[model samples]
Target: MNTTRGADGKRTGRDETAEERADRMWVELIQEVRVAQTGVQILFGFLLTVVFTPAFARLAHTDRVIYIVTVVLGAAATGALIGPVSLHRLVSGRRVKPQAVSLASRLTFVGLVLLLATMTSSLLLVLRVATQADYVLLLVAVVVLWYLLCWFGWPLWVRHRHTSEQ
Candidate 1:
């Protein structure tokens, strides 16, 4: 068995070569992507149906524009989230798991960002339609802040606070 200090200088306590590490990371990344992929795919599917609703024609020009933007964001999110699968398929057995993992991680991160935008836009459209009030943007801003805090801020804070410098 072998052990090595990781980025934070803590011993990983695992006997794994670079290829093994890449394999493990790839599996974990794929699992995480599956969860995000489901959400984004469902959201995109729902967005696709909005245009067919009779009420869609009655929406104000601003609301319609918002819908278009939201749908585009949703599509982008779906594409990014699913990109890893396609990437893996194309690169499988090429002895490049390490590079594939790195690229897949980047794609997942982009997907998450796109997902955030889609959610914000969808919420804005919903609130505007449900309540024609000036406070809608304020509410959307608050929600976006909450999402950022939960999705990125807290994790970063934890990493910064707990990680040891070497």
Candidate 2:
């Protein structure tokens, strides 16, 4: 087997030579991060405003805990999502783009996971306050499953299927 190295002496791509596919994956990852950052930022900003709302004063103790957890998770998501930018900035000309991109990708994944938690808790708080349905927990569980499927399950499935076919 032959392998190529980038300027920084690091192997690039998915254990293959750095080629068009690696470039495309990098672009896709950056795009995904952009979309996620936008959503998390907006959601986090809204969560920040909730503390000042009149209704916040009337929230039950459990609801308040949920709100706090959601806010903290949102903050963590924001940090992780923005991490790529900082990573790129610091290493922009270090001739280690491949390594930086890999690290940034991990940060983005962590951010997405945090974002999922934030969204779940946020939804739970909203639904719990909006109604007294006995199936609220079930509804949340369903939505979580949906997120896991869309965010992770589908991607992993595609990766495995493609690898097997190849």
TM-scores of the candidates are 0.93, 0.85
Expressed as tens digits, the lDDT of each residue in 54-164 for candidate 1 is 999999999999999999999999999999999999999999998999999999999999999999999999999999999999999999999999989999999999876
Candidate 1 residue pairs that clash: none
The ten-residue window of minimal lDDT in model 1 covers 1-10
Write the residue-wise lDDT of candidate 2 on 87-133 in tens digits.
Answer: 87898777677777889899999999999999999999999999857
What lDDT does candidate 2 reach at residue 154?
97
Candidate 2 lDDT at 115 equals: 98
List of clashing residue pairs for candidate 2 = none
